[model samples]
Target chain A: MKNFWVTLGALVAVGLAVALACYRWHCDEPLHAAARQRDALAWLTAEYHLRPEQAAAIGRLHAAYALRCAEHCMAIGEARGAVAQAEREGRPASELAAARDRVAARERVCREAIELHLREVASQMSPEDGARYLGEFLPRVAAYRHEGAPTVRLNQ
Target chain B: MMNHTNDPFSEALADWRVNPPRDPSFRAGVWARVEALRREPWAAYVRRHALTSGLALLAVVAVGGWVGMRQAHARADRDRALLVQVYLSEIDSRLVATDGTP
Candidate 1:
């Protein structure tokens, strides 16, 4: 009976340890977005065979671009909120139209920021890699994302 | 039958077999001692089966480690696929057609 308990305890301990190990294998929901960006950057660096210096520079560029992207996204979100509020209050059509225009402008800014980031990343690579990045890789990446939006709809 | 009157060893053996210990509680005392010896300590029980238990523990660790590693590898592959899905969605037809053209 004592041996049974001891063996059972050991088995439970091992089961918990294995469970924890498996849990760590997944990127958490909030971390998933960041992981995707990091993995994408890592893939690019590896595929291009970038030098340390080039990678570092491109990393900085990516960071800057991310900041700009965030700012644009925030603006778009704020405009959408304002539009919703205006609609709720039964505001003038002109006011809603202006809010819609504001949202559109922010979206355009975000797209341009993404484009500049791509250009900067490509420029940091070797000429051959840069051309392929701009031509093949960037196109494939864009086509999959549907006009540079995230997989999940931001508004929805 | 050849009877020898000078055989003292046989006589002593017969006497000892016929005349046992005179203590009234001798059998009870012997049984008590036997019971005490029969009860084993917990540590002794573990020591006796240490080899088997150790082998079982080793097997558990090996199987757990293998399963954990396999699960982690599978999750990593799935994560990589998701990252690729996110990345490749941005590509356009024109950009793909112009491979390596600056």
Candidate 2:
């Protein structure tokens, strides 16, 4: 019986040691996010030859833009939901068309705001670099903009 | 009873009973040897197996570091992909110019 207790205690101590090691080394979400953010800024700096100040400014702009985007996305989602609901209920053609038009108008507004924001970002770079960056970057964002509409419950 | 002295097994038993002259500490000596064998400290045991232990530790650290690096790399890739999406959200000027007036 005493041997059994001793063996059990030894096993428990070893288990605790391994658990502590894992806790010390494991990555958490916020740290991971921060690292990625740093990597993205680094990528921009390398790609555009951005000065330190430009990198900082662009990073801040992106952060703010992300917040604005969330808001715009939420609004767009609501408009899309209304359109979907109208269609599902077999509303009159005119009402459905009006809902569709409302979504389109809101989308146009979102697009304009986005373009203005891009211009602000580009202002930090040389004219050639800015134009090239915008040309390359805009299309990727556009691809996903409408991709999620069908799958996502945008209203929520 | 046949003549007891004539039986070889009886004679041998009688001789052993008369000459029971062995070490009484035999059992104690055996146990002491076992304790000596089992009482080494863990540090000493590890030192004795240093090469094997070091290799095992190295293997663990190498594998753990690799997994951590892969996870970090994957996370950065995902974030970069997201940044591309964010930048693209600006939409092509052509689309903005041709689509509905805001």
Candidate 3:
């Protein structure tokens, strides 16, 4: 009887986990922007006879955007490194601040480019699809909720 | 309502429309391909079996750990409660004995 109860308890625990996962994923309430992008691409190709060249071109532009973002990310890293070096040498972190400004400038450019790309995408996609894409990305820039919290929300 | 014909996906797709990119002849160069895609589609890359299995394994281990912690807590509480009950019973008997002596 004790063993039977233990087994029953285990089953119940597993059931609760499954329920939690279902609730968290929202039973399909969650949006799939990636899947939507693929669909849009396929539809564009099939509907408009968009040459592979054209599709590839847009893909390239996106790639350029990614590189720019990466550069900004790298700049931020370099700036932080400079600050660490300064601290070790008992010097002011003024050099780090200058590096930070460089990163900030690069990031600003990346943001403008992202906006331009978004404008192009909005012009190409349906209103609903545009909404879904924006919904996925805009939350990445949300302000901090608490101290020491990591702020990456591309899943929204 | 449970039939496939009434699926929500159907409704979503039915309302779908497209606005083709203005420049259809554009082609991404080698650099773009290397940097952006870096691999296959993002979905394909992320859906690797290794990653999926790793995440599932981590989740299972976490649940097991949580369950172990809860059982330990329950055991500790049970032991504490039993000790308190035994102490109270002994005190009650001594009080009865003293009442008779008085």
Q: Give DockQ for candidates 1 onward, in order.
A: 0.07, 0.08, 0.01
lDDT of 3 at B60: 62
Which is superior by DockQ, 1 or 3? 1
TM-scores for candidates 1 onward, in order: 0.43, 0.43, 0.32
- In the range A19-48, model 3's lDDT, one tens digit per residue, is 465444432211222123323344333333
- Alpha carbon lDDT at B45, candidate 2: 58
Judging by DockQ against the true structure, name the best candidate. 2
Candidate 2 residue pairs in backbone clash: A141-B88
Q: Rank the candidates by DockQ, best first.
A: 2, 1, 3
* DockQ of candidate 3 compared with the true complex: 0.01
Instruction: Residues B1-102, candidate 1: write the lDDT tens digits.
Output: 867566898787667756566998989999997776456555565677788777776777777767776766666655555555445433222212211112
Model 2: per-residue lDDT, tens digit, A1-156?
343344445545554555445544554444345335545556666657788999899988878877777667666777777888887889999998998888778777777767677778888987888998778655544553433332132122
Residue lDDT tens for model 1, A1-156:
665566668766986686567556542433344344646656666657788899899888866765666566556677777777878889999998998787667656656656667788889999999987778545544443443343443222
Worst 10 residues of 2 chain A by lDDT: A147-156
Per-residue lDDT over B5-53 for candidate 3, one digit per residue giving the tens place of the 0 to 100 score = 7888988998899988776434556566666545455445445445654
**Per-residue C-alpha lDDT of model 2 across residues B19-59, encoded as one tens digit per residue:** 57799999999999778647766666567667865675566
**Which candidate should be chosen as best, given TM-score against the real structure?**
2
Give the distance in Å from residue B25's predicted Cα in candidate 1 to where it truly belongs.
Answer: 85
Worst 10 residues of 3 chain A by lDDT: A143-152
- What does chain B score (TM) in every candidate? 0.48, 0.53, 0.44
